[model samples]
Every structure is written in C-alpha cells, then in structure tokens.
Target: MSIQTSRRALLAAAALAAPAIWGRDAVAQIRRGDELTVGIWGGAQERITRQFCATPLERQHGVKINYVLGGTPERRARAYAERGRPSFDLLYLNIFESRQAVKDGVTMASSANVPNFANLYDIAKIGGYAVAFNPVTIVYDRRKVAAPMTSWRDFWRDDLKGKVIWPTYPGAQGTSALLMAAKVWGGSESNIDPAFTNIARLRPFAAIQGSQDQLYGMFDQDVGAASVEFGSFTRKYAETRNPNIVIADPTEGQAIATNVACITTGTRNQALAEAFVNLHLSPECQAAYAEEIYYSPTIKNVSFAPELAAKLILGEAAVNKLVDFNWDLVIANQPRWSSRFTREIAG
Candidate 1:
C-alpha cells in the first residue's frame, strides 16, 4: 500500500485504540503485572534509558519492561518482516531512519500518551514520526589548536591536512558534515559536487567507517587532531579526559543529529509502547537522560544539568543556523555520491 494510505490507516487504528486504552481517566487497559518489551540501541543510550525511564516506569506502572538492544533500523525492519509479530514494542532510530520507518509501517502514529509532544522544538516533530534526543556539535582540542576552529571551513585548512578524521558517508552525521561543507563552499543544496570537492581536499586526512571508540582512541593518543562527532561524545570526552577540548558554534550553523523513539505498528503491547514513547518525552525523563548521556533534551521547559546545558544546542537561535537539509534529495543521490566518493574522494 501507498505510504499515505498506510499513515491514514494507522491514524484510524490509533483513534480506535485510544479510548479503549486511555479513557477519560487516562489509564491504559494493560493490566498490572504485564510486561512490555522495548528495543533500544545497546550501548550508552540503553544505559541512560534504563536508569532514567525503565526502572522508574516499572516502579510507577507495575509493568515489567524488557529491554532489547540492537541496530535500530535493521531490528525494526526485521520485526516488520515478521508480519506484525514485533519482538519489541518501541524502537530508537535516528532522524533519517525514523522517516523511512514510518513510511515502511514499522512505526505507529503518535498518540496523546506522549505528553511532551507539545514541548518539542518544531524540528523534533518532523513528519510526526520521531523526536530529537540531542543536537550534534563541532568539537576540537583547544590546547592543541591555536586558532578557533569554529566552522567546517577550518577543517579544509592546509594546516590540518592529513590530521582530520570524519565519520562514514550516507549516515546523518556524515551527511550533515557534507552539508556543512556545502554551506561553506556555496552549495547548500544536495548537489554534492562542492561537498565532494571539499572532501577531495581533505582526503589525505580522512578515516572511513571509524567508530566512536576508534576516534576517541585516536584523540587520546593524539593521532588525529580533530573530528566532527556527536555533541554527546564531545561533552563526555571533555568531561572525562580533556578539559581543553571545546565544542564550537559555527557562524554557518550546526545540525541536531538525533536519536528518535517510535512505537512499532505490530506491537502486541500497544499501551506499553505508547507509555514508553510518553516516558521518552517527559520532562523528568528527558532531563535525567540528558544529564546522564550529555544529550540535549527535547522537552521545552526542562533544563539539562549545568555542565550538559553548556554543551547542548537548545533554543531557536541555534536551530535557525542548521542546514534545512533535503532528506529525499540526499537519499535519492546517496548511491551515486557513495560510488563517486569511493572512486574519486577516497582514491
């Protein structure tokens, strides 16, 4: 079926299910002692979620929450392919995958149980499928680099050649990095030629498919001078080892690379899934997770911890500077760009 038709059907289903699960009293039909399964990313995010959301949820609702960890899109797709017998009720996806997941019937439509839906920044409500968990920022070692490394333009400098590291292409973080380059080089759209040209210039410094572990290791060892990584990573790195490490707000802008939560369409425990979605958006949950993980909170009135708040990219002013990326354009051209990058830029 077409995506619109599917969305309409899901909306209809949600409308029908709402009153049954959440009447005027706002209580779901899920009985006490029942269990709900949630699928989240395995590492840091999971730890934060369990500490902030899961344990509290179980205590409050008397429902056991089974936490499952895996690669977000792959696991969600596998659940859908199983013909609606979803192994997990909720899934965590990045922005791009959240869009595609909703289109693919992997997620249910948003419901009223998600209380902080109104608290979201406009960007967090994109296509009504997912919400932002944090804003990504540019990071550098202040002591090692004498000049202020404020923008993508700084990475292209001759002085940093063969000393920079970046994430792999086609990922949102990598795509945003490319868009940042495009913005600096005068092609902010998905034309990508200018971005590739910039990539070509930085090819000598490039490290492909590098994980956070590898990048942090490199930074610790001083093998790489700088990298464009998630704000959370930067904040944690700064807090733990390098007080000299600094996050920059570019004159051009920064992207809020996000981890979004969505309820699956085929969940056996719809109420529980919706509750989990609600928990994710709650001010308490958002604040707790933000402090623990150093990700920016999406809830409007909530404040992150002082140290984390300093690192977060909150408010309209910061959001305004971000590239209004065309996801459709990027997805359409990704293969072409990937092929060209492997041949020309990587060569």
Candidate 2:
C-alpha cells in the first residue's frame, strides 16, 4: 500500500482502538465543525504532522484543522504583523523566534491550558511549546577526512582546504556556526567580532549552502569535505543516502536548534489550540517524529532503543552539556552580523 494509505489505515486503527488517547477534556471542548488554523512547515514534515497529530485530532473530535504551510520566516512575520488580531490559532517557530515572539507579545505564554507543557524537559521551555531539539554539529565525509573531527577548530584544518561548505547567513546553521566560530577563538555572543575575522580564513568555500538538500547534494558529489550542520539532517542523510557521512560532537560542545509550537496571542480558539499543542507533545507523536526525521523529543516521557537513543539528545546529562547562547543578544545582532557575513565572509 502507498504511504498515504498506510497512514490512513493506522489512524483508523488508532481511532478504533483508543480514541481516549486524545483525552476526554479535549473531546468535550471540541465541537463538530470547529475550525483551527495553524501556521506550519510543509513537505514530509507536514505529512507526518497530519498523520500523527492533525488527522488523528480531526477524527477524534470532528474538527477541521486548516494549515497555512511555509517556512518559519513567513509565519514569524505574520505572527508579528497580526499580533493585535492574529488569524492563525497556532504557529511553529524556532527557539529564538519563539522567545522573540513571546517577548514581543505576539504569542501566548505557557499556562494551565497546555497541561502537557509540564511534561517537557527544562531546556525545551523556550517561551513556547518546544517540540524537538536539533543539535548543530560538524558533519564531514568519512571517506575524505581520515581524522575524526573532535572540536570546532577542526573546520580550520589545512587538510580540508577548499572543500568546506559554509551555511549561508539568515539560517539556523549559519547563526549557530557563527557563534561557534566566535567561542572557539576566545570571543563570544557578547563579543562576536572574532567570528567574522576567523571565518574569513575558510574562504574559497565550495558553496554557501542554504538548505540541507543543497548540502546533501554537494556531499553526494564528493565536493564537500566538512561543514557545520544539524544532526537531524546529517544523521538522516547518512542513514538514508550515504553511509560515508559522519557527525561529530565537537570538543567545545554542541549547539541546539530547538523547534517550537505556540498559541497565537489573539487566537479565538485558545482551547482548541492548546489541545492541538498537547497532542503534538504526546509521547506517541513525539516518538513518531524521532523515528521518521531523527529530531530528538523535547519531553522526558518518550524513550527510544539504544541505537536511536545514542543518536538523540536524551536525558538531563546530554541536555545540560549543550552550549547555551544569549539568544536575545544574538537576535539583536542578527542584522549587523548578516551584513558583515555577506561583505567579509561570503562576499
């Protein structure tokens, strides 16, 4: 059977077997024909979300969920623009964006309504309901680089000259890498000059990649030796496309790209929105996400097999080791950094 058919079958079986999984309170609050609009990402992410959360919620409660699909920038822009009278009931944002959203009063803060909010790990509490933790690490071609990467400084190695692909500015990979570059050279978020100065050393890049697919293509062609990338993308690509790819947790540490879901500040359907967020945080949905895309769960309730657990950032110890940044400071400096990156580095 096709993937869509299988998903439908699974939903049917789930509804039949345990409709209570959605919770009685949510079922009672949601009336037939109730509509909820959400801003979310598209493609496989959308498909899996529908299968595990949206479709199941619809079936269980007889509600209609209308999705506004695109990248985070558009959704974030809309959230801010429509703050006074927001159209979307919920939106998915990255960690920094979500924190900014809350600070700007465009998104609602955690409340008793979102009971599952209490189930998440402390690191996932970034002003919104965090869904997954994506580690930004060094990804290299194993066959090309015989020396395993153990630190962020490895990017500047002479052996990998002219083969490194840097992430373009205005992206998670780019921002994380820039900060990492700063930290490795004695500068930091508070003093970011070193990143621009240091990053210039790795000039003559193969490409300034903007998307995982672009980077993956370069890796497949043997054009890229190493680069800063998300663990989810690298691990996913390595497992599905190329075993030669390998991820390294730098000696300096790993940077996390936490993805979040939030209730719009002026949403008319607060109850429904909270219910949807709760379902998305459910162990079943979180587990499905980990299995499909390799995004580590935000909740402590979910468990994975040993192999999968090793690949994910699970438990308090692993969570605490991640290098934390002053995101407010980072976001405030983004515009200036973006310009410098273009002129000095990628230019």
Candidate 3:
C-alpha cells in the first residue's frame, strides 16, 4: 500500500480500537439505565432515527434514548444554553448551524469522535457528520406550465409571474434560492443586490412555501413553479401526492442542504454518543434514510436500486456538481437579508 493509504488504515484501526478498549467500561455506564439524549427533528426524521440509530444503540447497550424531538432552532438553543452541562449527547443541526456551533465551541470536532467520518464523501465532512443531503431545486407543476423548466431563470418567466411561490425569508430554501438568483444574474454571494432586485420584480406571489406541508399544498393553488424546494420532497410528492409535480435541474446547479449530526460539547456519554453516531452513519442506517425519505446518503459506500437511485443525488461526481452556498456569508448577512427580503420581496 502507498504510505498515505497505510497511514489511513492505521488511523481507522486505532479509531475502531479506541471504542472497543473503553467500551466495557462505557457499557457499564449505559447498562445502568442512563439516558443518552438525542436532539432530533420530528416526523420522518424522528421515525427513521428511532428505527436506525436509537433503537439499535438502546438494544445493544441497554440504555434508553431520551429523544428531544422538535425543530433545529429549539435544539440549537438547548445546545448553546447547556454548553458546559449539555443535556443533548447528540444534536442534529443544519450545515450552517453546525459550523456556527463548532466555531462557538458548543460542539466537539465530529471527526475526532465519529469513526465513520473516514467513510463519508469529503463534501459531507464539511460542517460535521452530514448524515443526509436534501438538494434544493426548482419544482413545478407539469400541467400548469406548458414547457418543462430547465433553469433558475425560468422562475422569472412572465407566465410564472403570479404562479411562482418563493420560500419564506430567512429559511434555508429561501436563502439558497436567493444565492441561486444572484449567481444566475450578474451577482454573487458577496454581491447579493441582484437577488433582492430580481425578487422584488417577481411580485404578487401565489403563496409562501414555508413548511413541507405548505410546499405540497401550494401546488393545488395557483402555484405553477417553486423558486426553490427540496428535490426529495418534489420527487416523493410527484410519486405519492401529485403526479403533475416535476423537479427542474437548474443550469446554475442545485443547492445542497444537509442534516448534520454533531456531538455536543461536554456530552456525559461520549463513547455511547460516538457509537450512536457510528451506527447512524453505518451503511444500514444510511440506506434506510435514503430509501425512506429520498434524502441522499452522505457516506460513499451505501447503494440503492436503479429505480431509487434515479430519484436521488448520488455519487461523488453528482455531489461535486451541487451548488454550495458561502454559508459564512449567508449566516453573517442573515439579518440584513431578512430585513431586505421583508421590505422588498414580501412587502
């Protein structure tokens, strides 16, 4: 083997060995019925996590998973508030939030703790252990629009004037959509003036596609096109909810929004938390998440049937093609962007 490959092998071996060496002691900590709290989202996320990560860890370790299920904001707040004495052993955040958490020292370096970090795609390792990625792209009603939309520019078509619904301001989808708008125009992330200007021009939106339910329900109204929505939702909605819905592969590229898993700083059950994260990133859990929710796996080894693969954003090549936001800029300018969006676009 090459020197680098040999070194990587040694590191992986050591990572695997560390848990095993201390697991006997860790098992005692857990087998005493200690609760390892996991702050996660509700709905499909909660269901899949329970089935794949929590139940398996609980069964194997004889510990209970105290699930704190809610939105990311609440979970993030808890992580920040309880920094030195964190209640959440494992906290789930979006890529942006995860970065901020790491910077603020609210979260531990996931690579140091998560052994499966070695097996994931390099892109997925950016913020933390990004378990799944939901591509943000354009979704349109096939029946309402005469032609299939191919680019982000289609969102601004005269025909789609009153039919297109923008995601609410400060939301991930909306933030991503703004970046896309700026890019396709003559601007970039640092120069976001064009995005706001163009968004204002596309006035009298049909409705705000805020939540997942709202995104699905908007199609029944005058909504012919979504400025930006999750591709997984669009694909699933097309199959299960609305046959007329179609996801547009924009020429500019799709934004990658991810569900990142992080170990909170000062986690009491560090070993168990690492073990849970390891299992969460395991092939079985990753596959289940991809198959169940249509979110693409972050790990490189997980595979899907051809039919299912067609619906997902798979492989390293495809992952590289995704439009990555300047999250540092996005997060920093959020307040100003939100104010501008409210006064210009939403007003």
Q: Which stretches of candidate 3 lie over 4 Å from their true place?
A: 1-32
Against the true structure, what is each candidate's TM-score?
0.84, 0.91, 0.90
Give the lowest summed-lDDT range of ten residues in model 3: 1-10
lDDT of 3: 0.78
RMSD of 3: 6.1
Q: What is the lDDT of residue 320 in candidate 1?
A: 57
Global lDDT scores for all candidate models:
0.66, 0.82, 0.78
Model 2 pairs in collision: none
Ordered list by TM-score, greatest first? 2, 3, 1
Q: For model 1, what is the C-alpha lDDT against the true structure?
A: 0.66
Q: Worst lDDT window (10 residues) for model 2?
A: 14-23
